[model samples]
Target: MSSPTSVLLAGGGSAGHVSPLLALADTLTRRHPDLVVTALGTEEGLEARLIPARGFGLRFVPKVPLPRRPSADLLKLPGRLKAAVDAAGAAIDETGAEVVVGFGGYVSTPAYLAARRRRVPIVIHEQNARPGLANRVGARFTTFVATTFSTTDLPHARRIGMPLRREIATLDRSALRDEALAHFGLATEWPTVLVTGGSLGAKRLNDAFASTVAALSRGGVQVLHVTGQGKTFVPDVPAVGAPYVVVEYADRMELAYAAADLVVARSGANTVCELTTVGLPAVYVPLPIGNGEQRLNAADVVAAGGGLLVDDDALTPHWVETELIPLATDGDRLAVMARASAALGEPAADEQLADLVELAWGTRA
Candidate 1:
């Protein structure tokens, strides 16, 4: 009998990278129950806990991210890359993988390259508006390239939006607002703002929101703040008209979307896609750091008229008081932005990516 088909998937670093991989894994398993999927990542990454929690086996590889400028770690990159390649090869061998799918991170670079060396077909998913270094390198070896944006410059890249979870794809806030509000112990009478700082949270976002939450509350804005794991922020003690529900982290994102009138968060690719897919008008503050890729992602949404992007340096409570308060008040304007966001939604992207992955693996099989 032919051995059961297996796939080696690689992704790491942030939950943004890991969540999509898990989403795809969930989709693949639901479609083909017998197909084996193993995640290749670093032991230290967020994936180490997340991947296994989803019931998939994880194979670890040591990897250090390559910085743009030359440094001591740069000198060790060659050795680290070699080690990661060997680890990826072993994982592929152990899983009897017919092909590899890389989800664009440091972990993916060596794993996909190892698959290429072994003549195994590879597929890559570029989730960002601008491709990351790993996906850019992996694209050359990829049998097919899948991207969230149609404008990706990767050779032979196809327009398949980010693979979102079923809940996100089919979410409708109309009927569930009451239930979502009740879950957060909030009243449904007031305007709501959902503030999330990604899975790990953003300090800048937390600080800004903490400072402004009271003012928003006084303006009759109810808040659901996902503050990440370790951070704590105390809102004003006086019951200022509206409720402020704060959570360290939330697993039920769909519910959060349903309960929100507007979103105030960082513009990570996952957040961008979720906001677009759910048709949520948002004030996006991209993490102001290296490469400015997050800003680029936010620019696409702002340029598309779906949301507004704020520079981190300029994100003050006064600005929020002026801009976001007014924007939130104008329901008509919010609806216009919502329509623009809905226009960008791609609900069928998961199936499209599945088809691409199957085709890539089928040829090798």
Candidate 2:
């Protein structure tokens, strides 16, 4: 029998980077049973826990955060980065990695540099519309780049969509609608809207939705609000008349997506990809900070007639009452939006990314 093809995947810190890495790793292993897949991350990153729990080998490198401004940390950056690169080089050698796949994060930078030094092929995947700093640096190491959005400008980038878990990629909302409603204790009769602001929760989303719960309930709409973990701003609105359910966090997002006819949330890359993939229309309130990447994330879906984009500052109770209520109540319009969303979704992204990695591996051999 031929020896196993060894591969190293790098990314970490946030779920944005880690989730896709896991998805691709899952795909690679399933396709080639003998594939030896290992991941590189920082000790402080979510990958430390998530990677091992998924049954993959993981190695950690020192976190070398790039400083945006001159500071004491910036002075230490050169040495820190060199140390990280050396650690990653040791990992590459130990794993006998022939190719390295990178999802942008602190780990990716060192992984890319080490791979280049070792003459190992590098493949990059960028999840956001605007490339992050790590991916930008990593891109120079190789021409193989995959992106979730077509508009993402990276060297030799192909729009491969976001790598999603099996549960989400194959979810049939209609088939599981009843079970989903039961899971959330929601009524099948009322149109349900799922509101979320990711795991950390958006204070603006929470406040705006809280103020408008009564109005939404009055309009015969039900709500499933995920307030994120540790967020404490409870809405003053009475739930006696409204069918409103608020949870601190949702562990089974598949159920929430299955139950929801509409979603009200921020336009993070993963959230937008999952929503569109499931054919769920949304009211995207882009986070009002950063490089305005959130707005760019939602732009294509909204333009394709799959959803609506409301400015963070413009999202108010009155906006929900006037705009969202009518849209949610119109079943015909919702169906149209759902169709548009499904058309834009690339459900085979995991497989496609695995193909890219395989291609890179072949090139190196």
C-alpha lDDT (0 to 100) for residue 140 of candidate 1? 85
- Estimate every model's Cα lDDT from 0 to 1: 0.84, 0.91
Tens digits of per-residue lDDT, candidate 2, 258-328, equal 99999999999999999988999999999998999999999899999999999998988888899888988
Error of 2 at 192 (Å): 0.7
Kindly report which residue stretches of model 2 are placed more than 4 angstroms away from their true locations once superposed. 1-4, 232-242
After TM-score superposition, the amount by which residue 201's alpha carbon in candidate 2 deviates from its true location, in angstroms, is 1.0
TM-score between candidate 2 and the true structure: 0.96
TM-score, one value per model = 0.94, 0.96
